[model samples]
Target: MVAPPDNDVLRASALHFQHHDGSPALQGVSLGVREGEVLAVTGPRGSGKTSLLRCLAGLDRPQRGEVWFDGVAVHTLGALARARLRRHRFGWIDPVPVLVPELTVWENAALPLMLRGTGRRRARRAALEWLERLDVDGRARSRPHELRHSERQRVCIARALTVVPSVLFADEPTAPLHRAESAQVLRTLTAAARSHGVTVVLACAGPRRAGLADRTVTLLDGRRVRTLHLPPVAGPAGPAEGAEPAGSAGTEGRPACSLSA
Candidate 1:
């Protein structure tokens, strides 16, 4: 088992999970994400990236192993406790932006704060600020169905940022957008996270997208196969320029391929 790293905001140790039909989805996966840093989990389809993300975010529990967030053992929390933690501390952006059909863009962005009992006006103000930052404020009065897919994704990002949660789990958040739109949204998201010191764990399918992060962890068939560490640069989003080559290691004694740029 890999031990959680010191000063890590989130850590997963030897996580093992199974699908509803008892098919193994994750096998002894371990990783750590530091506070205020972005870590991208990248892999091909059916490689367990989503499962690992869900387990780390407390949305699902691993059948074996441990998940820790800021020193708290997430696996031990009850359903209500886990729900409360998710509500108050963590933020999530899924592959698809799921929004309330009746709510306006700003209203949808402010939903989390409203659910937590913040006054509607205050929530709206905060939500608008994030929307503006994400370049979606012009559409604040529009309903979800009225916005384009890319715009909706931006609004979803605004919603996640409204609370400025300690950590954000984004699972292929830009998958529905075109290349240019994806890059734009990623730039905004990473800049916002850096400015606010929000830790981020982004799961994606390709290295090009994963390059936006400070580090990348690659998974193959439910196990970590390699780790890439990129040098610090001005922007936290987009590809790193002149980045050091990535390091690799075998999984279960199998030969690992290089992730070098």
Candidate 2:
């Protein structure tokens, strides 16, 4: 297989996937994410946004197509190798925050670092730093069950950021949040990513959410229909004309984020 360019952090070519019941999800989809760029995948429900994100992140393999990451063919990696890649090179945030019930919020956030063999004291310090960045530091000692949905999501973001993964895959990360909370979380996410030069592939169900991305790829009926490149400076004019509204972007009802890592 031909390799992607050196500047491309992740590349997907002619991807196709089907559901367990034999329903089509992604059909001949292809895209590339540049280093440190935030690319948003948007489409109406069942438009294959989640499936596409999964394939790119190596959480799910497509029946046809190739996924290249950092010069490696991700689709060809064994399960264990893929898992290691995810743990070491990628960060992920889901629509719903899934934390370890027994662990405190900080502990949950530190889990990734701990798994990587970082010392508990150092991991806790790093996790707290991220929690503060996400504005969830006050809840550090609290358990996931004790926090609100938004707070839980913030902690999840903190967890993902603690490792400072090279690429972050966020799927409907703000679905459970209010408009203001969503904006705040997105701001934190994007800001941290920019500062760290983390490439982000965010699957957003709403146009408002996609507004935060540098560019958006729209899918229809499991196929990529169009790609919209947003201006570097967003003005008051609001979503460029012809941009697809969130309503038109199909939601596949799949789990918001990848749990593989």
Candidate 3:
């Protein structure tokens, strides 16, 4: 979502992540994603696409380099600080839908806000708005177990967007949907970002719908190779969910620095 241009967002520099054996998962990646922009990070499976996003979201830390959000270096933060930042400033949704089988659709959508201290009534009201925004209000009383695969996917998505964060980082995002449903979800996410001025950065395996990206970074052999911009295209306004607050912003990035390169 591009709300008046973000004052702070995120940037990554010479980032790398390693397994216990010291074999690399992601190596020396660097990039920037701005507010109101969507950057697709794509590559083959096992190419560190997920790991790279984890580093950006502070869910996984890199062994080398830094991830800066709103000018704060994530690599330097304590674990608790990073967690708070994630809750308040960043939203990360995995490619697959993760919904509680027993929770009603409204409960799933309202969880984030309720956790953030909003009253149940207020949260559910917000949840209804999101469901309506996504055209899923009719499913509000349905449990995840009661939904069709695609509807469950949207419920998961509605939950993710409910908190209205500054930046939304998602992985896969559309692997389960048919081509048309996948396209629809992409537009919903994109519109939510643009409408709220949130920045949406996603990890892709190279199949973004024809016009969802504001930029694309190709990761080849575990390293970033190039970056470019896509023309603006329209999408859904928002999912009535909250993501995270906006934080760091950086100018465009430099060539990815790498020890192995």
Candidate 4:
């Protein structure tokens, strides 16, 4: 077996995955994330960004290839083991917010830490801190149903950061927010991760929202690429005279892709 690098917090090699109906999601993709680094995986829809995040986060195992985390072989771990690892060491934020209806916002944010045996009071304290950071602390006592969709997403982002997990997998985390709110929230998330020494693997539909990452890796049809030229946005009258035009271009993956400072 090929060993992971000593400095890499997460690494994947020759990853291959397919859906139940034989649709491909990842194809021989490989990459590495250094400790405390924020890496953005950018691509258009159906480019395997989310699939790669799932495999690296242990939410799904690749049919072929290896995943290593801090020198441990994550791909070889059983489902139960993976669950435990995720609960204690990893955080995740989805595009949508999901919270327990019966629980208050703070309770939902604190759920993971509480599940890990943290004292209720301590967990609440931690949860409240993150909520405030995400600008959702005022709704701490409100149940999930009481909050707006954007508010709920903020709470979810707070929840994911409360534990300060070693690695956080965020898939389109700001999809529900407006552009202004998205920018503010992303700044908070990335700033917090850097301060806490947390590694982040952020998946996005395009590069527009990936500027906060230390480095970015683009994916195309489940494969890594050197560049992904997105088509210009179409205005009401159609493409502007000097618009770059609608299309994309990319190259196959390169070697030793690193997150440079």
On TM-score, the leading prediction is: 4
The models' CA-based lDDT, in order, is: 0.86, 0.85, 0.75, 0.89
Q: By lDDT, highest first, what's the ranking? A: 4, 1, 2, 3
Q: What shift in Å separates residue 91 of candidate 3 from its native position after superposition?
A: 1.3
Please write out the lDDT profile of model 3 over residues 190-230, one tens digit for every residue. 88878888888887775445258887776755677543222
Clashes of 1: 0
Candidate 4: TM-score?
0.89
Looking at candidate 4, the ten consecutive residues that score lowest on lDDT are 251-260
Task: Residues 119-236, candidate 2: write the lDDT tens digits.
Answer: 9999999999999999999999998999998899999999999999999999998888899988988998998999999999999876778888898888767777644322223349
Better of 1 and 2 by lDDT: 1
Candidate 4 lDDT score at position 120: 98
Q: If scored against the real structure, what TM-score would every candidate get?
A: 0.85, 0.86, 0.81, 0.89
RMSD of each: 9.1, 9.1, 12.5, 5.7
Residues 111-175, model 4: lDDT tens digits: 99999899999999999999999999999999999999999999999999999999999999999
Give the Cα error of residue 18 in candidate 2, in Å. 0.8
Q: Residue pairs in steric clash, candidate 2?
A: 43-249, 43-250, 44-249, 44-250, 45-249, 45-250, 45-251
Pairs that clash in candidate 1: none
* Model 2 error, position 142 (Å): 1.0
